[model samples]
Target chain A: MGGPGNAKIEVVLVDDDALVTRTLSFLFAGEDAFSVQLFNDPVAALRHLEQHPAHVVVADYLMPGMDGLQFLSKVRELHPESSRIVLTGYADKDAAIRAINEVGLYHFLEKPWRNEELLLVLRRAGERALLLAELARRTEDMAAFREKLFRALL
Target chain B: MTDAPGIPDPCRALFSAHADPAAVLDPARTIREQNAAARASFGEAAGRPCWAVHFGRETPCPPCRAGEVLQEGNALRWMMERADPAGPAAPPGVWEVTLVPVRDAAGRVTHLVELLRDVTLTLGLERHLIELARGLDLEIARRTAEAEQLAGRARELQAAIEQLREEQADLLRTERMAALGRIVAGVAHEIHTPLGAILSSLELVRARLAAGRTDGLNELIDLLQEASERIRKVVQTLRAFSRLDAAPVERVDLREGIESSLALLAHEMHPRVAVERAYGPLPKVRCRPDEVNQVFLNILRNGVQAIRGQGTITVRSFAEGGVAVIEIENTGPEIPEEDRERIFEAGFTTKPRGEGTGWGLAICRRIVREHGGEIEARSAPGRGATFRITLPIEGPL
Candidate 1:
């Protein structure tokens, strides 16, 4: 789990094609605020996410064993605070949009996407995930403090 | 018989001289006089009743014209059928009877002259003509029915040919649409992957430039050049594939066309399928270059789809005996015995519905035949399938 500014944003990128995943990882290499993990298979990515939680999970929409949406939906169950993003081709734009609305996904990035837009969107998603994690920690802290006060009163 | 009469000698002479059987009847319907012929025919009946002597009846026969002739004071004629007097065992004989009334000077009918002629021979001829006409009518009816049946069969054959034509057109359209879909999908992946690499590498270079770092600049440019070359090759091959308005026939290196097809379909066959090529020295063959490329593409795509997890596709080309021969073999499952021959037929497919149009090989066979070439498939149970195509060195004259 990542917190506010200056904390490293853990990013997990999943795609069946190695060329796609490799270039995406290179895109985030220069930014010190982001750390990216790459997986060529969606099933393997899901298995990795079980133990190593990510702040932002980026997935390609088309894969052989499991599609990006099914993988990301399972990611949501594993880590509700992790912001999800999907990569799609121009031909599947309509299906990707529907997936965004149906799965409550954060956003969809089209293939051959501009580097600047991709970086900006991932940056924002990471910040949002960090804020949600912070909020959840504060809520837990508040509950624990209330329980202590009630016990002291008893 | 001529001299014996109850009348004048002139009338008796005339009646006796007549060739036909003639009899004179009194007002009481009895025979009053008989000529020599009547005496011979009726056995000398002079006082017997006229009806009993002529018709062998107990009384006057029905449809008698005697009363009508007497009242009208004229002659009457009618047709009748009776036993043949010449041969009693023969069929009935027809007769025409004539009754003439004899009157006195006061204009009152007093007697009737009955004449009988042997007309059975003329009636027999008339009956034979009527029977021939009836037989002609039956023959005409049979011929008309036969003509109708032939026309019906011709119509059914025509309809069957029309349906086959429609099915052929439908298969052609479906095949064209399927080819277009495949081109769109494969082209998108081939171009988009390299373009993404080039752009992303450019972004990394810009970031390094902004940071004033000069290291690894050559590697970045190398990546850019490599990606650009790939795009350039894809475009060039695509241009070759789109030569729709070019010359219909050209002397082409068949190997180049095969390479172009393999380049366009590289994205679909990579990583899972290995391609091995063995090209022998060959002369240029005259063919439609674009159409030949399409054939290679379709066959290669089929080879790729046949293999499940991983397999190898082998392509070999050589020239022999004034012909160019190309063989493509894949290490996939063997084609069934029943489907080997029918695979080239239109609308025959093993792929599940919606995945194949079943006209790939059908189109291939047609295009080859158009160029005066031959295409065939061979396979055994354990061995894989191989498609062999041969084209004449010089196209159809």
Candidate 2:
């Protein structure tokens, strides 16, 4: 929702570890024409994010506040148009599985992620998020038109 | 001439010298003649039947040898009893009598002579031999019965020993199986956390190296090392525990066994319950290592379950009365006083169905008893529960 003149992509990173957030923020900072927000606490990130929903959310699996999967699920509800990326060390299989089915994840990021791999995943997620947002806008426009047309007919 | 037996004078002298009563009778059994010995024993017998003079019977005695002697014209012998003294009602003594018949030239039986001999002493000895034979038979029968009873008692002893051995083997098998289940679950949880951390650390390091940020590189490596080290400890402890199941009996440091069991359960319990150890110096206990390990596992598992979520578990070990003593105390809701007594009773369960709770404490009791040890539970409502196990340091009893 930033002005059309400022057409930069929006990305959000949430994790329990401050180091992971700082490192991931640095990794995504190079001239990709995108804005990155890092949150060490998922609760704080969610409160700020409700007012300004991001295009893509990258979250850690195990955290002191909430699990990665639960946070992403919450993100899916609040920012319906955002793409979800799940980060996990995969201590167990169920975490990954839940991230996919429960959180409706867009991508799986294994620990020790490569630079190129993360970027490629983020690029794809940005495009998908844009398309979903456009579709939602169109659906709302059509609903408003139907309501107005019905009132005029009356 | 002897066979002729006409009662000649020389034959009469021999009959008299025989020292036995003698008589001569015609075929009609009339006492036609009598010797001096017969006259002395029977008074007058001339012109009287032999039966009338000797037995005082009206006719000849039945089974009389006179008839046999007359018909066969041969000497015949018989035994009879007669009152020769004619005193008071005296018992008649036994006699051996022979009837000899005399015949004419035509071999006709004309007269018969009879002689009687007493044989009481020989008959008395035969009676004595029969009584001795009966007593020997009774002794043989009594000894045979005694031997049979002893054999039956030995068989009973053997059967009792066999039953005891079977019970011991069954208890050991159940305890071993329970230990394996608990170890498997604890290992899974223990391995999971470290593996997760290792994966995350490696991922972050890999991302940093691509961007040429060498700063804090050593810290990332250290995290990876620490995570893997945690995982390696779990593996080492599990391997040591697996080795114990194969050894039926061994000298075990009580502390090592308690630590091994705690490590296996630490994964699930670490997040839920706080643990503190107060181990003291102890002797090596001789026991079935796996079974002893099982006792510790069951008690610890119960302790973990008693704590719903946020509680403390304290494990203490010491030596008392020549026994290795272990105490596991939990700061959970205290068990009721009534439940404390029955905690180790078989088939007693407070856990809901499908939780596998009933046999946990019971199996612990069995293992301890089999090793010549003791286990007891003490608790007051809302205070907490403590299980005390005392095992003899000596070999299995």
Candidate 3:
């Protein structure tokens, strides 16, 4: 078992509702293995993402500045390895499908979520990030080996 | 080549090298040397009559160009529109065929060279252009229809906006009246307390003077007491008028409120008009009491004003199904159906300008709405008008 100290997962939460963000922040505050950062403005969160990357990004669907899908698309372009999740009040299937196809989101959660279910999803997302990091490292090693072989043959 | 009499070397090569089905025939309607193109065009029909190859018939085609060339020895070109008789697989197509006469050494027109070209692809392209033009016309029609519908919708929206503006103006007028009513009610309440004390003191002074046998002083006290009571009545009237702007909800005894309204309108009553009351057991209603009284006063005043000669106005009240129902009926000329709904509107009145403000029924409606009650007037022409008010009763006790 990996201890909380050894496995520190950081997540960024973006939503227009202050109450929802604060509640989610409180829920994550008690966990040792996770760190949560809350942002009411999606644009500000996106600016923060450019400087400081997170293991996972959770966002709300309907917002004033930039909708959840557009924000997720930008996040994917900026940090393709980060896990993305969408929380929405409206059951918009078209938006959800676009997010899946364009942003490659890991999960979608509706509003008024259960604390345990959200935490579990985040934990799973963290594990997925770890696996992706390992896969990228292996791919880089394989590319370098192929370059050496080509040089030796030349 | 034995002086191949009439065939040009380049034209013969063209006929030989061309891949499409082609043919050459003589003016005598007989086959000449069929080139490779002609062999592929008419497989087993080579060496047959030219008309047999073209029309698939035993005889020559009518108005044959080859025959015309043979007669005049001149080059002839023409187009033909004809259906192929060679079954379903035979593509019906237009052909542009030309004929050039070949003369002998004696200058006699002998053979005619016939050349045929298929124009199916070009004709199909023309047909496609026509279909495209038709589709574009349909698209234009649809767009025009959509634009017309949008224009109609815009006009409807404009009319709706104008109507809304009129309604908003009426609401503003009603709000101004409500504000004034509130101010009057507050001022009346403020004066009533002091007026009540003054009247009590005057009565005490009258009693003392009368006991001491001062007759003149007793008359003065009586005058003062009477003036004070009159002021008190005015204050009460003002209070009732202000209640029209009272806060939306409060407990009110419906019967008592109705009686107070009748008392307030007593001064407006004419000698020819008689007031009758049929008070019934009514429960307290949850409403703005002053507003409810205003509704009663307005209807009663209208009823009294409607009668030209002697008339009686009857007021009735009762409770039913957790609601207080009040009716004011008059024995005056009835309102017409066409004018019934318009009567409640501000600035609408059958009475002449000076006799009616026309705002009375409108104000009554606004007050009733604020109390969450309904007021309706029912009448037939010459049957007299009856106004009914229903207010929800407060919970038991």
Number of the predicted model whose lDDT against the real structure is largest: 1
Off by over 4 Å in 3: A1-154, B1-129, B132-136, B139-146, B159-168, B171-218, B244-246, B270-272, B336-348, B357-374, B378-384, B394-397
Candidate 3 local lDDT, residue A36 = 80
Best by TM-score: 1
DockQ of each: 0.28, 0.06, 0.00
Best by DockQ: 1
- What lDDT does the true structure give each of the candidates? 0.80, 0.74, 0.69
Minimal lDDT window, size 10, model 3 chain B: B188-197
Model 3 per-residue lDDT tens digits across residues B1-397: 2334456666777766766555555556676666566565565454578766765656666766675677777888876654664222234567666776767678887766677666667777988988999989999999999999999999999999999988967775775575445334434323432343344334445555668744345444544565466567766766655565456566777766666666655533534567888888986688766666667766876886687667788888888887788999998898988888899887788997544657778778877766667788899776688998877786322
Residue-by-residue lDDT tens digits, candidate 2, B89-130: 223676677899877778787888887666666667777777
List per-candidate RMSD values in Å: 6.1, 11.2, 33.9
| Cα lDDT of model 2 by residue, A1-154, tens digit | 6432345668888866544554555455553656888887788888888899899898877554465777888899998779999765444454567678887889888655655676778877887787777778779999999999999999
TM-score per model over all chains: 0.73, 0.50, 0.44
Model 1 residue B313 distance off true place after TM-score fit, in angstroms: 0.8
Q: Candidate 1 residues B1-397, lDDT tens each? A: 4423334567767877888778888767788887777777777777888777776667786867888898888899987666534222223466577888877777788788888776788877777877888778878888888888889988999999999889878868778776876676667656776787788889888988999987666777777788788778878888777555467788888888888788776766766789999999889999998788788888888988887767889999999999999999988889988898798998799998856778899998988988899888888876788999899989883
lDDT of candidate 3 at residue B306, scale 0 to 100: 81
